[model samples]
Target: MPSAPTPALPQTTCKSLDDWNEPTHARRIYGNTWYVGTCGISVVLIATPQGHVLIDSAPEKASVAVRQNILSLGVRLVDIKTILLTHEHHDHMGGLASMQEATGAKVLSRANVVDVLKSGKNDRRDPQFNELAGFDPIVNVHAFEDSSAIKIGSTQIQHIPMSGHAPGGSGWTWQECEKGVCKNLVFADSLGSISDDSYRYSAPDSLANALRESSQRVAKTACDILITGHGTASDLLARLDGAKPLLEPQACVNYAQAGALRLEDRLKKEAVK
Candidate 1:
């Protein structure tokens, strides 16, 4: 399918480096998949006839902006039934509590992620825990193992555990159809090996191994379209604007390779320092 035309959205930010929480117009990814997030973060809404399932709820400061953005796409606030989480960081899921209340949707994530959100703090197990931020306590959160999945109507949304960058980190994957054509879609979380000062990626229990394994898993998943936590990670905005191919068979592999390469370089630099 050809990509859709993107409206001219203003170039706005939160006045902080790497934080673009300002609201932007929503656009369709494939058939039922919609991108209703801010300029910096990416939030996916899989709308089904029965209800909807949102991938991530941007940062907390943009809570209302995200809600309005979803509403702009003609989605009823109450119709959002389930919210699938990706990473447990404040930048990624800080607004989950408000989103859960706004839509009255149940939150689902990896078994270990449930604890971090409940405490409204960063996970100590994360490499960047020292620099991470906290958010409002998320309620009605439940745990799902690798074998389990949540659904929206007939769609089966599975949670893929990608817990290297952030402990208990995970991504959401499912299929969406348009004109009797189905495409595999994945809301992949951040896979870069980012950390605070004094943290090493070359330790005995270093997360580098997990990051590499997760890359392999995502590469094998074979998604038609891949969405990352940050729009620039996959050039999502460009893809949506028809600047790039909306469907790329090698996109997942390329994404996985890029993430793995980043980790490889980070480890190499850490060793020399």
Candidate 2:
């Protein structure tokens, strides 16, 4: 699958790219999975004979580096067949519009976020809501349900609803095999109870309640390897760089607990406020 290189993005005058997109080397996580994003964010690649699957994209400025890294790993942009987003956050999908154009891949997202993606507007239902900065509008998006198992060649990706940190947030899971041993890799979505000053995670807020349930469900789910949307969340870079072990049986459990605690703490503060 030979394809032309992704076109260069003109250098923007803004300082955001320099701050958010710390240049980081890309590397294989396990088997066919690869970590190919900036230091502050996470972009994943799963390759197969039919094509490849890309999970998340960097901020707009970081997209160039991401595409370069993909090429460095010998993956053609056109080989990326399916593009999935963990949420509607700009840091996660700012590059998606251009990425979709570059790769000519089908963009799949939760049905609820289709409008936000197409319009390049903040999702009013999101905790951050009006505080969010819009990204470039994406086009030709297809909706997929949580129960749908998206298959491309030998790879199968499943979605797990985790709409609390933000609307349309989700976790993804897939199996990766290495040297006769296979590990269930989970790309857990952001679980931080972040919000604008006006928002609260208390029971009255429907989104907050959803997060509570999501954390409980995620805590119970078992997986061999966990890769969070933020590299720092699971110490992704450390694990990939050999500073820490990658396979921890209780990773998801611990992650969920930590997120739940954060949400609880936020709620307590909101009560006081």
What TM-score, computed on C-alpha atoms, does each candidate reach? 0.91, 0.91
lDDT of each: 0.82, 0.83
- State how far residue 8 of model 1 sits from its true place (Å): 14
Candidate 2 lDDT by residue in tens digits, 73-102: 778899898899889999889999989999
List where candidate 2 sits over 4 angstroms from the true fold.
1-19
What is the TM-score of candidate 2?
0.91
Q: What is the lDDT of residue 229 in candidate 1?
A: 88
Residue 135 local lDDT, model 2: 95
Residue clash pairs of candidate 1 = none
Task: Show the colliding residue pairs in model 2.
Answer: none
Candidate 1 TM-score versus the reference: 0.91
